[model samples]
Target: MINTRPRLAWHRARLLTIGVAVWAAAAALLTPVAASAAVDNPAPTPLVSFTFDDGMQNALTQAAPTLKKYGLTGTSYVNTSCVGMTTVPNTCRASTDVPYMTWDQITQLQNTYGWEIGSHTVNHLCLVSVGDDCQATKLTAAQVDAELANSKATLAAHGFNATAFAPPYGDYDMSVLAQIAKYYSSMRGFADTGNNPWPLGDYLIRNIPVQERTTPVATLKARVDEAITNKTWAVFTFHDIRPSPSQNPDDYQYGTAELDQLAAYVQSKVAAGQIKNVNISKGLVNGSPNLLANPTFNNGIGDGWRTDAPSTITADIGNTGSFPDSARSVKMVSGSAAGHLFSPKVPVTAGTNYLFKSFLNVAAISSGEVGFYVDEYNAAGQWISGQFRKRENTRWVESMNFTYTPSSTSVASASLQVYVTGTGITAYLDNVQMLALAAGSTPPASVNLVTNGAFDAGISSGWTTDSASTIQADGANRGSPANPVNSVKLTATTATRHLFSPQVAVTPGTYKIASYLNITARTSGEMGFYIDEYNAAGQWISGQWKLGVSAAGVTNVDLTYSPSTSSVAKASLQVIVQGNSGLQAYFDDVRWTKS
Candidate 1:
């Protein structure tokens, strides 16, 4: 067994290891490969979660109805002390003028619309002062504990099981996280500004804030696209939904029209089986604890971890690397003697499936292999059996994920062991996660609604040009590097040229339009992109000019648009170049898809 040490000593060692140069070199060679592997392995399904904060009245009146119309649900984080208040309390971080939801109304969100109710502390006290409205004073340890425990208790009193928490102003530190872990299963933060990766950091769940004017419908749909492509989870944070929201971001309010558009876009993706729209709790898998303490190596070795042949293992190896959620990883410098790192034994059920995952950066492997195994223990704490889950032999950097189930019903607990054998093999491991694999359905294939989007055949294949311009296939001016094909080149003189795409059949839902353009030569005016709407009789009903660009370089433009009227049955993409004279441009990779 490996020896344990105090956390203070481990922190000092971690600080000492920060100056090591080898870790930086290994990370440089390993980070990109790890990122590429994450994109390549699409096993984790994409998820989108809509979460509202402060329990504002509009959450029930506006957000819930819009979400329900699309068969989607959301999570509402409420401040228990401010419920039904006409004015916000000074202790709370919410707007002073906005009204909060009544307890009964909050119940409707849970029982009627199927939304999850989470905690936002009792008085919305900031755990750490970070220069925000909630940061008037820093709370003591006792105050923090009371805020977490009492809010959860209050929710339970109202028949709500609040497992997730969002701190006021997203203010928190390691101390706050410790207290949060004691009371909540997950913590959603403000301004985290990206999608959450799979095997999510339950306590540090990140979110993208949606504010009025700043957050466009296109931006929200693009986030959904990112989740789909990366196979990650996207949590959108909203504070208030109003009929006429103030444009100031400080107000933290969003318009109902834009909210409806975003909801419709999410529904389209759900309908196409590209993403699953879930509440906060439903999005989390199993809610199981990561049995390995100090899994990320943030506290260095000898903290809930031990190794045979300590000379071969280096803790707190990397400080600046693509280590997920943390800046450190453990390094193994192996020789002919095999070195083994062991995790603390954690209780496990006999028939349950467990997912063991770790990000590995193998800088060099000359003669041996790195293996991950699960060692099973009996009820009497004796080693019973072991299973070799996965091994890496070549120079590689990727996430190693394997599912292990105990062979016998007598297996009581298990410990994860990573062993490196052979000569001259050096590897770094980080973010080791072991939890039960949640049950889920397989994702369906995604479809693109536009055809001949790359202009592969010719300009006339699936495109039309108006009388003001002459369109020809240009092999020299392509916009997309991936396509690498002929693009439609429009030449016009002092007149607006219209290049129309094939009409795509439409429904009363939001759609995303994308195209790449390069204004090779221009004299006076800019190029415009529009979505033309047509009624069932093929008559033009409405058209929205989305964007216009005049720069003499490659420009990628994409926007989300919903039909103005229900009578519209078809829509077409229009690319127009209006200039004085001698105008030339290339357009390629036009895409219109149900968002």
Candidate 2:
């Protein structure tokens, strides 16, 4: 087996023996000089945290003993909903088997083995692709919310206090991470390069996968040795622990011999006091960013900025030729491998909000946009993208601020960049800053109500279908001008018409419309909403808008259009149903807004 030493100061110590016989080749190749240095001064030992996911039975019956034999601690994330929920014990046919452990078994393992339990999100879903967790379809945003909040309640009820979460499918984008971080202290995901053996803390940590195709026991031992030598924690994650494992598609079973070998290696480390089993979250708090010792930014005035990555510097004129002060517009002529420069790491608390600011300028030679982005990572090495960018004209300095609510990590770090887009506009930036905000003081804004239904009070804020069927408010906040509605629906025996328009011309711009409604049946006709506008001729332009429905009750629908439709003097928002059939039904709460 090829065993590589860890990256650390060149150091070495006497070959400490605890158990297994030393291979002649391995021993001879050992650097005596390096061992001597380690004996003189050892590097700070790092904390190791082990976490497992998808509680396979084999993990408990097979892997547990091995882990225990090594005096190691492990946390397993489980899907509570999967317990006793299916008759079929295994669903192992897919390329990757996705199965859940029975609650009874999971409880037994946790209670008897001192294992930490965490939620895997109920109904396991990809939250980023979908919008809100409650209202999404396959797994509605509501369902996702229920999965997280309800699972917590269930675990607590069952005496399991789970404070971490492993996003379902190991698939998450910035938006999903933002939402999930709201609930979990530590989030786990699949392994990635530069993320293996994961980092510690609330942010993305590392976990190495142990699969069927993994290297043999000897190689695994060598790697473990290297990790110990470097004082690095190596977490080995697997799905199952059995030979020729069946039924579980994701099973990465180990033979009895391999398990014994791992146990022995762990025993040696414990005997030598070379290893300490610790919780993953604790590791993050203890690990510190490798800050640059003499970070400098050439592009800023007086070189006041410090960044780990290289930055571009350019020259210009401003305060230099003026009376008050000497100011030269310094531009970062280029970006580095790490993107832009950021301040040294600062401690942050989860559940709290924070504001980060940086000074930037746009030069006359450049144009387009000049802005910044917030960069954060999750336990799985996933980056959490921030919102909004600051723009400036070619004239002066501007401050860009990013505000966010943190999750489990104690300190969240960010990078700031002053970039110019388009053409003929170059910008200089400096004085980047970050500040934590108090919770509940303010939250990101949300869309509460939108409507085109405008009518004078007490004048029947309903729809008038001239010569057809007229509609009135239900007086229960339904279809009322004052009370924004959600759905608009009506049931009538004959053909009906309604006059619908925003008391004011609908604001001109690209907009989206959403509402819910249903009809008893559209046996021989079509059901749809309508948008009315006017052409150069000052005549109303009507377009057929339709949304299909599945069953009874309210069917929510969303539509989009350009501002040109509402830019005219008397343009409006209208919903129309046209056909020769009777028993027409219409719905309300129709709203038009931007995405």
Candidate 3:
């Protein structure tokens, strides 16, 4: 291993000295109060932060130039300890070289080209699983501490202000977050982009992880458009660069053309002033405005009709459709802005199906279309190809459905919009919903995946639970805000029974199954997961399960299972938290990924 530590440390120290000077310079150049004000919802489209992981050298050679050409900006999370190490020998399957982005290269990208730097830990272990035992196996607390402090110090030394981190392998639990919050202001976690308005309210931000290098640019755009429509802040996590002279090829690295296409899209958005391209940390600093907190609309609902944006209008409730109580509809009350509504700009993964629906007053105009779109960006915001969904006839009972997919997964953001292009067809919409369909696995047998679920007497639009399941608000918080630990335990019992599966659309493929569980006891109770094979006739062929040892804590389990040879097009994931312990268990983040 080439020990670049001494050189890296020295360079880092020098760079930090200079960075402080530059930040001081930049600070001096700007009116300090102006900078502060800019953070408070400055004019300009909101920026979508794009981040790449693993700090592979290709980031410099392949990803950076594309970003620079387009004037887009981004952050690359580096594993500092791997700075001077040689490419892990013969073991690398995709490229012959080891995958660490060198300290020296990182400096050039930051100082010369202006790329933001972030920490991926000292040695990139699954930070979430790193307890004392795990730390003892590889690096120590001192080492991990060094990784955290030193990487920040190193970036500062390299003239870059790194204020963010994307946990190694994008894995981190509460304990992992506790350890990280001590060092970084914000961290990135994995997210599903199928639905937008990115998961909010946390130092831990969710991101879309790009694993396929083969995805096309157009497809990438469609996905991005959808994300924006859902008003989601999209983040992309990556590793490896394309066609490198290295051994690790299968790792999620993008080809040069693909990387360029992605970057260009972001740059186009920036050039148009649709968004201000900035690093991930900056996005963290300018967190999305809590629309509800602002004194703009009543009871905290802006409804995409902004005072700042002209073509949009908020109207009084009128009779036309269904759902009578719905009020405050958007009307073409006047001007060129007559049919316009609000939308987002972030992008999403291509080929994914998304469902969008809204509650509207029955009196509003009978029908119209909701528009969904996305804009892809590079390090600089730029335009790349994307997709959109146009829903035609609106139903009085509810909102219309508009769904689409981009040709690329590399888009930066998307937009969800509604317009009354037709005359005299005004609509009143509320309780809008955007749901990302689960991909990667077929559903298991014997479990009816619930849609728009009700559990513990509370409801979420896209969740699943037994409609027949009875809820008992054991305490005063039956539906009260306090003591919200209500129970609606599944009543089904058989040789084996399962509950809780969300709307999952699956094609035939091998998949990896996983879910998050909150166990109430540390006993033999296990959450049994299954992969069922149900034919068109609703007949079950076979399925498999892995009994996870349940404990009274939030634990995410990755199940070991595969699909049967026969084509099982439609399936549901089955979960049964069964055991004599009689402890309550809650589930979240159920995932089925095509391997």
In terms of TM-score, the best-performing candidate is 1
Model 1 lDDT tens row, 1-595? 0011110000000000001111111111101011111121224779999999998888998999999999999999999998878555533457667788889999999999999999999988778784547666678988998998899999999999998899988888755665565567678989567998765656667889999978888999999999999889999999989999998887888999999999999899999999999888777654235556777787777555777668888785444223234367788887545677777666666545666767666668765567776777677666666655556667765557666666578877777778777567888777787665322222221234677776766666557776433767777635343343567887765555677777788998888666656667877667766777788888777777666676675555557878878888987777666646566877776656675
Q: What overall lDDT, based on C-alpha atoms, would model 1 receive against the true structure?
A: 0.70
Instruction: Evaluate model 3: give its lDDT.
Output: 0.45
| TM-scores of the models, in the order given | 0.49, 0.39, 0.41
Q: In order, what lDDT does every prediction score?
A: 0.70, 0.45, 0.45
Off by over 4 Å in 2: 1-44, 47-49, 85-87, 90-104, 128-143, 193-201, 246-257, 286-595
User: Which one wins on lDDT?
Assistant: 1
In model 3, the Cα lDDT at residue 7 comes to 12
Kindly list the per-residue Cα lDDT of model 3 for residues 1-595, writing each as its tens digit.
1111111000000000000010111111111111112232222124466677767777887778877777766688877666655566523222345565567888887877777888877666655455532443544445555666777777677666666777665555543444454466566775423322322323456666665544556765555554445444556666766754223334565566766777777667656655455577655323222211112222222433332224444543442212212223443322322244443233344444333444332233322233233223332334443323333333233234343343455643333444443233544444344444323111211121334221333334343433334212122211101112432343223223345444354556555554434454434545555555565565555555445454454343445444565555555555554535455554433334454
TM-score of 1: 0.49
Error of 3 at 448 (Å): 33
Candidate 2 lDDT, 365-458, residue by residue in tens: 3322344433443433243432222334344433343454443463243333333333454455533434433344335322313332222132
